[model samples]
Target: MTSKRRATSVTGNIGESVLPLVAKQHLGAINPLDILPLNASSTAKSPDFRVRLHPQFPAAFRNVTGLTPNIAFNYWPAESKAVDTRGNANGSVDRAIQQLGAYWFGRHSFEPNVVGYGLVCCFIYRGTRINPLQEINFHVVAPASMSAQTSLLRRVRHHAANGGRNDFLDELKTDGSQSRRQLLDV
Candidate 1:
């Protein structure tokens, strides 16, 4: 059977064609942060990420690059587990934090069109580059255009913090496991 997981590598230029395609193909009606699978109390519905295009960002940008203007999503997970991957080595915690911080810098530095397309795609590329075994990929289908009604930057930062914590923990867990295997073999 094919692995339940999928992997993809995509590269696109900054231009108009990419914008609409990204919107139509990726950003449809879904919120950016809401990309995670939704589960909640009996009455509570699975939430969605609130995503929007920047109003002042100019429709002209659409024409300038001939691509969809850059789009981003806000995300939060209801629960997470912190696994220690740092093995039994000293400075593991510090190393994990440093790696995660570097990952975030790599993510935020991506320029629209110059980098990959949507947030998820860019993340997968970064993840694979940083950790070869742990590759992630997902896509959302929604067509509604949204307004950047609230503090977009703040929301993005919040999501980044939450996601980064999990990444740091996961890295430590991976490192610990690899170390264990090595010790067992020796």
Candidate 2:
């Protein structure tokens, strides 16, 4: 298979493997009826799988309440021409940002305070130039939360012409080690 296809296949296996584990661990916390394969159809944007919280979930999970879905995921293989290649992240990272952003919106809607928590998880990669993004390399899980603890508006709005802009993208273009480390810690 082509590298891209191989990468996708491997990633699929990983995702397939995780769903049951998550379902088992979450038990009452996750909505089994709606969680798996949330809107996988090609007509619109959706997560590879979503973590739909139970309706009775605690208020600690809530924020302002605009009503966005809770945590969701978008899967990308860690292999070559996928999430990373030759030890450097590739365009797939960009796609994750976009997709995860969309999922957060779909979960959050117009209300910034949705009284529910949401997070993004990325499968980390360790690779070499020879094997590129192949799974033969190590893979780690990194988490990022869009919960109220981190202001989504502020994070995305930093790019505004407002003098206070954090040069967010620039920081990313430069050495993103600090920001990346922050995500890993999440």
Candidate 3:
């Protein structure tokens, strides 16, 4: 007897394909090439998309920082039952945070010229047979900084004081005004 293969593994692939289209439709002002995958790999650890600051961003901000702020988008599809657990949201958020941490501390650690890095945790869920909407959540782990910026220092101090948990990002995610597309604008 022939058996059918399960669709669990391909859910993320589907999300990867669909998210760029969603982004293009919603974020038409930005260049489509910027919203691209990190690499050609299909590994689970790879970030789904990376969006760089558009040229239209505030000239002063870009000049002062001397680095274009970028956001890494990580897609987590909820339809994959094999990976979906009761604590899936929490797990997914943690994983996204971990990936950002790895990038900041690993590849970009010594890059003094680099200014800021942001991360977006995208949760793609099917609300109906014909509707699949994504809940895009974001956190600015590394705020933009010029030389001797007190704000960046203050953020570091706050994170150190709070035992490294970013309550601010959590609060931002809870605030309904900041949508996924809006986060990319930063």
Candidate 4:
């Protein structure tokens, strides 16, 4: 398989294996029925998972309107070396964000019951003696508002204008490292 396909397969396997544990350990109780696969046929781009309310779920899980809000999850795999640098990691994050943004902005005849979305990126370090699974570190990216989209676009434009170099993602890389450490500590 191509490198891209291999990476995707690894990412999918990790998502399938880890997401349930993550939800249970981090987000309190979650029923199996609450998780669904995104509909790939309808959207050019889609998240890996869609989380909604289960019929028998507790009242505490419901929103103010007493309805379950949908959450989108996307999985990504990254090389530790690539993510160590702002420029290298920027490409990966930008691509993921662009794809997610497309889903956010695209017109759909049938609207999905989604409220927010997140990207889960797993970074594997090079030449590590430990198992790749153990070495993998995860980071999540959730844009707070449409302003993030505009900011990303501005960065893209700036990069293009400056012959494709920008430090816009410098802080993001640091934030990812801190987030990963925090998650592992939990």
lDDT of all predictions:
0.29, 0.36, 0.38, 0.36
Clashing residue pairs found in predicted model 3: none
Q: Backbone clashes per model, in order?
A: 24, 13, 0, 0
* Stretches > 4 Å off in candidate 1: 1-106, 109-153, 159-186
Q: Please give the ranking of all candidate structures by TM-score, highest first, separated by commas.
A: 3, 4, 2, 1
User: In terms of TM-score, which candidate is stronger, 2 or 3?
Assistant: 3
Q: Please identify which of the two predictions, 1 or 3, would achieve the higher TM-score against the true structure.
A: 3
Candidate 2 C-alpha lDDT tens digits along 25-78: 542333345445545346434345544444433232233332333433222111
TM-score, prediction 4: 0.40
Across residues 1-186, which tens digit of lDDT does each residue of candidate 1 receive? 112233355343222122233443543424443334334345332222212433312354344334453344332111111212212222422332233223332344352111111222111112232343322222221111222212222333444577843443344235443211211100
TM-score of 1: 0.18
Over 54-134, each residue of candidate 4 has an lDDT whose tens digit, in order, gives 222224334322333233322221111123223344455545443443443332113322212343443332323232223
What's model 4's lDDT at 24? 51
Candidate 3 residues 1-186, lDDT tens each? 012333766544543554455445543425655565665233324345554443323353455445554323232211111112223555555455444433332223344222224444344343333443334433333443333223333433454467553443342234242211122212
Q: Which is the leading candidate under lDDT?
A: 3
- Tell me each candidate's TM-score: 0.18, 0.38, 0.42, 0.40
Off by over 4 Å in 4: 1-12, 52-94, 107-116, 121-138, 144-186
What is candidate 4's CA lDDT for residue 130? 37
How close to the true structure is residue 176 of candidate 4, measured as C-alpha lDDT? Answer: 55
Poorest 10 consecutive residues by lDDT, candidate 2: 73-82
